[model samples]
Target chain A: MSFSKEITIAKSSVPKVALLVLATIFAFGIFEVGFDQGQLFSIVFGEQAYADLYIHELTHDMRHAAGFPCH
Target chain B: MSLFITIILLSGCSAGVIHGLVNLALVEPYLDKAIGIENQHMFASGEAKDTSQFWAEYYSYRAWQKGGQLLAGAILGTAIGALFGIVFGYAKNILPGNSFAKKALALAAIMWITLYLIPFAKYPANPPTVGDPETILLRQMLYVSFIAISGFGALGFYQVFRRLKSKRFVAVLGYAGFIATVFVVMPQNPDAITAPADLVNGFRAVSLVGVSAFWLSVGLIFGVLWQKLQPDRVKQARFQ
Candidate 1:
């Protein structure tokens, strides 16, 4: 297939798109749990202490439950 | 093709379960101690109101927490294994000499070394109570940059080795030199870890052990499964 035709075919493939979406979600989830330190949403909204604390508290139990290295 | 993906996912899930169980049995005690220490510090600093109540709750929810850890491990493992499967599939097409099992094991070892061991040693994970909150972003950036450097550096070394195939000793020396350069040039962590030395060491050791167990299991299970599922492939690999 030509390069453009290949691109078109890939873009039209539902399974490919679904897999891409799933992979993206999985990567984001890993980043949030493993590296974000529970400040992901708050970080996107600028540095808001209350928001960060709120999100952290909300995820605190889950983090600990998952055995993440949270304090 | 789907069968291959299923095998990868199953292998990864098994690895993840092993990882979680290992953590629960061997590493959880040290981790609990570290958490207790952090909470004690928070209480002493007036950041927490009731450490006793917190400990009681923590103990009470032990079973639930263990279950959650296992579930998280399985999910994460499946995702990671799927990615690994895709990469290995592509790589096998390009590089055909080795068996799938050997390739998977090699990739697993390289990943364990570069992605986890080196980067983690440089910027070990700290408890939330350990570092200054303001420096969290900078710390994370530094940590991630180190991971990138380590990963890309390893790949670069492999490329160079492939290019200089005739001089294997020189290639080995070149890779060693590159690693030494990275060790020296990588920026030191600016923020001092505030956790007690013992606690920090204990936590790092436990975490490393858990991760090592996970990767080892992933490598072994995937290798065995791939070999079993494709006996013809194994025969080809032997001839190669």
Candidate 2:
């Protein structure tokens, strides 16, 4: 058998809209885990009137776990 | 097979989360004490709540936070680990036989150094009370940019090494030069450390331990799983 395996980058097998949606979800996930400090969603949605400490506290451990510097 | 890979990655992440939680439990008292000391003035001046009441609320919050951390770890691990698994699977073709775990561990070590240690040495993680709330975004951006630069720099070094396989001496010099330049050019945070020294040291120790445990567990578990699930790949690797 040959040692080298052929590798190729294929065009989208799924619809453009679906891919876009998936990309958006991935980006949001990254933001929530990495950048948000738990307030990104609320800030984006203009929910300044309400305080949600739960998400922040929950993600605090995660930030430390991922070494994102949650101090 | 893809689903199997995802499951394996998730399991590895679960192990990582368990290790992290245990480390947190071991270090929790010291951390609580540090936080209390750092904020004692606030409590005394009525700026912060009482320590007893705070601990009660904090422990309860942490009990729930455990579940969130596990979920987040699972999601993040599966996403990143899937990509890692694919690349490692391909790399198996080029490596010697029965060395998958060793190679994986090597990669994990490098990742730990470049991704966390280097950036962290420059700008250590501060606790919730350390910095201005407004500057949180800027601090996070700076830290992440450091991680990105280190990661790409490591990858570039590997590429350069491969391209100059005929001249090992030149490759070594080139890599050293590149790394030195990165160290010189990487921006430094000039902010003074205002937190108590012991508190900062305790937090840094625990945080590093937790992250190191997670990465080590992920690498070992994933490597073993991949080896067992795809023995044929290993056999092929031996001949190559």
Candidate 3:
């Protein structure tokens, strides 16, 4: 008995859903790591989030290490 | 389709974790040294008190920030990897390499040069004590804008590169000239460097190493995964 394998190449078009997902991840992750000034947590925590700077503090070291503007 | 996304995300996450670990070991020392300088300035200016309470809070938060370094690395890595995957999906065939792994590595290097090194040359990374709080927003805008210009500019010139089969060198020269012009036209980082030269220089050197590791790891991992999985192909069996 002999076995043969057939390979079919798919279209080159990048899936739209995949693109959207990747784009969203790109935006959200960059904002969180590079530019977040407590804006994320502010949704629930309100003004206190800005003062607390939870995301800012959490990402502080990486912020500087990764070359983003950090105070 | 799911497999493609999985490979992209997994490679990104893994590379990012590696980037975080690398930062922890190599970059953390510089961060501590710089933050120490910031603490001394705070004490001198009465922005913070040098007391047991302050020390306690400081240690606690420093621990938290250090832990977050790894988390942030993974996050940033994934974000960058997503962008990489999108590009690879489109440009894999056109890229100059015989294998997926080679192609991935080539693209990674290009991105590292265009998106990172060039922008970094304009606005190099600084330690914590270097920047002024007042000018941070402006600095951020400048940095992001420069990276965007470099990235999009490269993309635009790549089109010219594809169109001109005979003298592709012109595309390279054109991009170089365009970026040089932008570099001159762009505003400089408004904040002055107040930190010690040794600390700032050391921090930037190590930061470059950490980021370089991420790009390398992402390229290798993503390429290997893509090669092994062949997510874009479907295989069927026929028996005779």
Candidate 4:
């Protein structure tokens, strides 16, 4: 007796998980670099984060260079 | 899928780092010059003293920010690259060109013009002292809104182009007209240009160069990586 088998594989579709992950990254990274304003640090440092502006100062140069509005 | 995401991110990070390095060389001087003007203004206004302590803190913060330029470039590149990857994934078949690299480059150029260049024309980059602290939120909203409008508008028009069998140029004209109207209708930056014209102009020029370099690098790198990896290809074989 003889037996025949067939297989097919497709990877054409972009997985939703990957899209979601990339979207999240895109949003977070853009926010961090372009419009952070100490908001990220404020998550941990409370109100004082507003004063420190650690993320803001760190991204200050690029923020201006990349054309994001900055004070 | 993992490979797909990995290559996309890798290309972005690499391009971003390149962008950072380029900015360090081309853009840093203008930043320094602008900040110098800002320092003088602060001294004159008595907002800050030109003392050793002030200098120390200024240098320290400036150093941190200078370093952050590269880091931020990487982050921004990855972020934008992710968007590029997603778009490329969907549009690769339709994009003009024989190779992935060429197609990616084409897409990059399109994006650079729509997302960055047009918005930039409406709200060009300004140096530190150019913007008012009180109006920061409003300015941010304006910049982001313009960018979103341009980007989404391009996407919507692309759909129109795709559906048309001929005279796709109509969609192109439609987009141009739409954007032109928006350019006229949009509010201005609302901030006064107090900085020296030369300094502000120079800064804007370098800023354009830096961003253009990032887009070019991301496109080329992502294209090459995608071509090499063939992440979307999966082969299965069976014999009897």
Q: Give lDDT tens digits, candidate 1, residues A1-71.
A: 22221111111112354356446645764565445543666655666744455434433433433334344
What does candidate 3's lDDT look like per residue over B49-78, in tens digits? 999999999999999999998889889989
Per-candidate DockQ versus the true complex?
0.09, 0.20, 0.64, 0.50
Structure candidate 4, residue pairs in collision? none
Q: Please give, for residues B16-44, the per-residue lDDT of candidate 2 as tens digits.
A: 56654754564455545555565686778
Query: How accurately is candidate 4 docked according to DockQ?
Result: 0.50
Interface RMSD of each: 11.7, 8.8, 2.8, 4.0
Q: What is the lDDT of candidate 3?
A: 0.91
True contacts kept of each: 0.04, 0.21, 0.81, 0.63
lDDT of 1 by residue, B134-206 (tens): 7656766776677678767766766676577487567557756776687778787666777678776776676
Candidate-wise lDDT, in order? 0.62, 0.59, 0.91, 0.90
Q: Across residues B41-114, which tens digit of lDDT does each residue of candidate 4 receive?
A: 99999999999999999899889999998899999889998998888877888788898889889999999999
lDDT of candidate 3 over A1-71, digit per residue (tens): 76767584635568999999999999999999999998999999999999999999999988888889887
Candidate 3 residue-pair clash tally = 0
Q: Which stretches of candidate 2 lie over 4 Å from their true place?
A: A1-30, A38-50, B1-4, B38-41, B49-59, B66-69, B94-97, B167-173, B231-240
- Arrange candidates by lDDT, highest first: which order? 3, 4, 1, 2
Candidate 3 chain A least-lDDT 10 residues: A4-13
Badly placed stretches (over 4 Å) of model 3 are A1-11, B236-240
Clashing pairs in 2: A71-B126, A71-B127, A71-B128
Pairs of residues at least 3 apart in sequence or in different chains that clash in candidate 3: none
Between candidates 1 and 4, the one scoring higher on TM-score is 4
